[model samples]
Target: MFFASDNSGPVPPQVLAALTEANTGYAMGYGADAEMVEVTKRVREIFEAPEAAVHLVATGTAANVLALATLCQPFETIFCTPTAHIHEDECNAPEFYTGGAKLTLVPGLPGFDDKMTAANLRATIAKEETRGVHGPQRGPVSITQVTERGTIYSLAELQELTTVAKEFNLPVHMDGARFANALVALECSPAEMTWKSGIDALSFGGTKNGLMGVEAVIFFDPKKAWEFELRRKRGGHLFSKHRYLSAQMLAYLTDDLWRDNARKANENCAYLAEGLRRADAPFLHEPQANMIFAALPRATHQRLFEAGAAYHLWDGPLDGDPNEKIAARFVCDWAISRDQMDHFLALIA
Candidate 1:
């Protein structure tokens, strides 16, 4: 049983099929092919933003850093949560792409793990804005959907956070590495969850959902379309044989595969969370989408590890007493089955 991360799962058959179709004959290079045009059109239609500018990159990091670069100047700061992926995972790609822009982390919601509040945002942005060009001026507010702690920010919570950013005229950027998972959980339209609710740019992700590796940086206003394209090319993200990326994305979007894949992943997580809770395990943060952070006794962890189960420990070692609950993270993917989840639960038990 593999619960390490969604990243470890197999790609769906449809994605492989699309890739095969794309490989049949010659196509144009450098994202000039017809496949990309269809992918772009489909994305715009899905978001209900007819004028939105959409670009695809091979990694979530490229999409996020490039999008931030398009939104903010070099000296500005992007407001975000302390545990945001851009802050913890991307290794300063945002700063590099934005030519020295920095991230200012906002704190104090809960669970290291709760939603960012308007008060915190106002205070943080206010502090940044007071610098008068001395400090990093407030730039965009970057939010992570299905945030780092496996919790989701509700639409109201999201709107309120964005409202605070809007008050300071800060554009909102969502680092949506799990965008589909969050959207399915919220049961909201893409536009409602994004632009209509004050988001300016979104790193619409596909990698964790089921795609091989592709993410879209979608700007609601197309004004920066050319700038983003230029930045994408200059940053070396514009794939020379771009059709492979396009094919994967197209397969992801076609027939709602993206949503279905995320739903399955989320359902698997919910099931796993249920199993853990039934076993009297306490969660570090509640499972909301495709990820969960929970604690089990070190002995239980040892048992699972010896059983050949693969996953991550949030912190600390695994050589303590049987009753010492240590933190762990569980991520689910579409391909993980009921049998796999139950086997994992049994091993832990």
Candidate 2:
């Protein structure tokens, strides 16, 4: 039972097939391939932005940092939650790519919820620009959908945060590494989740869904498209064999494959969540979209680990009392099967 991460899962057969088809002949280098043309068209069609600018990078870090750098200046500071992926996982790539821009973490209210509120964001933005040139200026506000704690933000929540940012005329960027999962969970249109909600740019992810490795950076305004291209090239993320990336993305967007994959993942998570509930496992947060944070007793965790179950422990020590409960993270990928989930739940039982 591999509930470790979606990134560790296998690529879909269709994606590999598309790669094989794209490998048959020579193609232009540096994003000029014909496949990329179709990929852009499909992305525009999906997001309903005819004038949107889309570019592919090999990793989500490249996508996030490049997009942020394009929308922000080096002297400014990006506002995000302390638990944001850019803050915790990207290893300062956002700061490095933005050419020395600082990250000012917006502290959430006193609660387990890591999602930033409009009032908190307003307070955070207000705290900045006070030090003049000595302190960093307020840059763009970055929102992480399906937040780090495995919670999905609602449309109204997004609009509220964006409205707060717009009060200061700040551009907003979305860290959409799990964009499809959140979209499917909310049952909202892509436009509603993004531009209509005041998102200026997005890091549209695919690797976590089923692709081998590809993430698209989309700018709704299209004004900073060239700057992003230069930044991507400078970061060495522009693949010479660009058709492979484009091919995977095209396959993902075609026949509603992306939506289907996300639905499967969410369904799997819901199934697992129900089983966990039956097993009396306490949830750290409600399973929202393909990810769960639940606490199982140390004895049960040890048993699962001995039975070859894979997952992440969110907190507490495994070596202490056997009855102690330790928080663990279980991620359901598109490829995870119900049989595997049943086996895992059986182990816990």
Tell me how far the alpha carbon of residue 256 in candidate 2 is from the true structure, in angstroms, after superposition.
0.7
lDDT of 1 by residue, 241-268 (tens): 9999999999999999999999999999
Give the Cα lDDT of each candidate: 0.89, 0.92
TM-score of each: 0.97, 0.99
Tens digits of per-residue lDDT, candidate 2, 1-349, equal 9999988899989999999999997999899999999999988988999999999998888889999998889999999999999999999998999999999988776765469989999998999999898999989999998788878889999999999999999999999989999999999999999999999999998999999999999999988899888988898888988988999999999999999999999999999999999998889777889999999999999999999989989898778999988999999999898999999999888
Clashes of 2: 0
Best by TM-score: 2
- TM-score of model 1 relative to the true fold? 0.97
- Minimum summed lDDT over a 10-residue window in model 2 is located at 105-114
- How accurate locally is residue 265 in candidate 1, as Cα lDDT from 0 to 100? 92
